[model samples]
Target: MIKFDKVTKRYPGGHEALRSVTFEIAKGELVYITGHSGAGKSTLLKLIAAIERPTTGTVLLNNQNIGTLRRAALPYIRRNFGMIFQDHKLLYDRSAFDNVALPLAIDGVAGREAGKRVRAALDKVGLLNREKAMPIALSGGEQQRLAIARAIVSRPAVLVADEPTGNLDSNYAHDIMALFRSFNEVGVTVLVATHDAGNAEGRLLHLDHGALTEGVPA
Candidate 1:
């Protein structure tokens, strides 16, 4: 569902984040991108999400060239992706329910329907009871779970997570990975960028010095 053809992203200062990275991720496949810091993992994800345009080559999503997408079309392209971050990125002042509902609200989903979807997402992340609680009130694991809920609330076709388990303990990390596995089983294309090698399973893509290396089997 996503393909990168000779993709290279160079910053204004001539720092290339990705160099001729070519890969194709089929629909419903779960993949992990692993590398040390500065390996260009985040840049790869941003390219797919259209947050950063490739300096050279093309990025295709569902057969559409994203690199050439106009600014007005970016939001439509991004709606297909749900992104999670290591920082949680939750609105600390909003309730967990509201946080999860933000995407739906942006998409113009009605109150009753958004509530149903928000509650379902919270339940999937095992945070149903904390819907009214602020982000600061939750534990680290719970906060991460909340982020997961928010990401999946819109039922995105692809899920992109960057260092999702970075801030959590081993148990929490395991739980988070398991949650991702469950979503993949349900046919959501998942691409996770993590430095934690232990989480490298399924199809593994490695990066080194901005270049794409060989992929490892599960």
Candidate 2:
């Protein structure tokens, strides 16, 4: 589980991305962070994933204060999270198999074991047949799915997606949401930062001007 207590993040430029935000997300829950552009959704995700530390207050991951962690311990703490960006940060030149294999490769997982997980992840995203396909050869939805596959290839306890459906059509968006729900059903804690919930079946926390405008901590 993750918990934030009076957290605030201010950039060096004096821009406050999050101000006094507090929320608790339980294990195995699917949660959506909804808001307009510049609503601090991405910042919140980054903080939760420990990509960025809080400027003030505390961010606790299972009662461990993330902001106070030592530099060497950061990577170990981050292993609990799998992050999906809005840009679908896939390698343009790498094959689909290689793209999904990056995380396992970084973790020094052996080739045989990594290959099995990579294939399983691709199959989960309905791209098993496209293992050899390049990013340019796939559709927009396919690329997003590929990005998702890469994120989940490590099978982290928490899944954080930023605007996972922002660029897809309604049908594609719905399919992506269903995919997320499927993961949640099997007990992966999923947190999707989206502007539109679009019939999302989960707890929704809305952000406004860097503050928690709605939704209580679950």
Candidate 3:
């Protein structure tokens, strides 16, 4: 349940990343946002995640306008969605379990419950045995799965992935897509921004110059 209405994002230098973009995603739907580099895919995800405020119009999550959320209340809004990035964004000093537990820890979840959920999430990504492994010790695919575990451990209503398969080989990339599909089937709304056409096999939405292409359902 995410909606972008006439949204436009312009940087301080007056470079427009998105122009009058409008879209809506219903609950439990898995959609892909795809385009070439510099095509505003990341900009759109950032706006939805509230990492960047729009220059104009609205971004709504479950009927709440994210653009209107106060800075102090932003974390509460963010708690409703999970996000993954191209880099995996793992902590070099932390173990896989620690990384997956970060979100719950931030929300003040105590030891036992956090541990339970963290273990479940890592297992979902097939990394339960690697819980004690540092990010550097894991392969590229394993690190990416760990990142996925971290994102979904909180059980957020929506999952936003920005090039989650960017660094991996084709096999690993397909594995990541299958993981997303499995998550979506279990009822999480999945919005993925990708450049790989192979990943666009299901429910594709193409974007260009910050605008979604025709026939692309949000």
Compute the lDDT for candidate 2.
Answer: 0.93
Alpha-carbon error at 201 in model 3, in Å? 4.3
Steric clash pairs (candidate 1): none
lDDT of 3 by residue, 1-218 (tens): 78888899999998888988888888998888889988899998888887888889999887888788889888888887798987888999989999999999998886899999999999999999999999999999999999999999999999999998888889899889999999999999998989876636556667788777743443
Write model 2 residue lDDT over 53-87, tens digit each, in one string. Answer: 99999999989999889988888888788889999
lDDT of each: 0.90, 0.93, 0.88
Please give the TM-score that candidate 1 achieves against the real structure.
0.96
Model 2 weakest 10-residue run by lDDT: 209-218
| Stretches of candidate 2 exceeding 4 Å from the true structure | none
Error of 1 at 31 (Å): 0.1
Compose the digit string of candidate 1's lDDT tens values, residues 95-211. 999999999988899778899999999999999999999999999899989999989999999999998988888888898899999999999999999887674568888999899
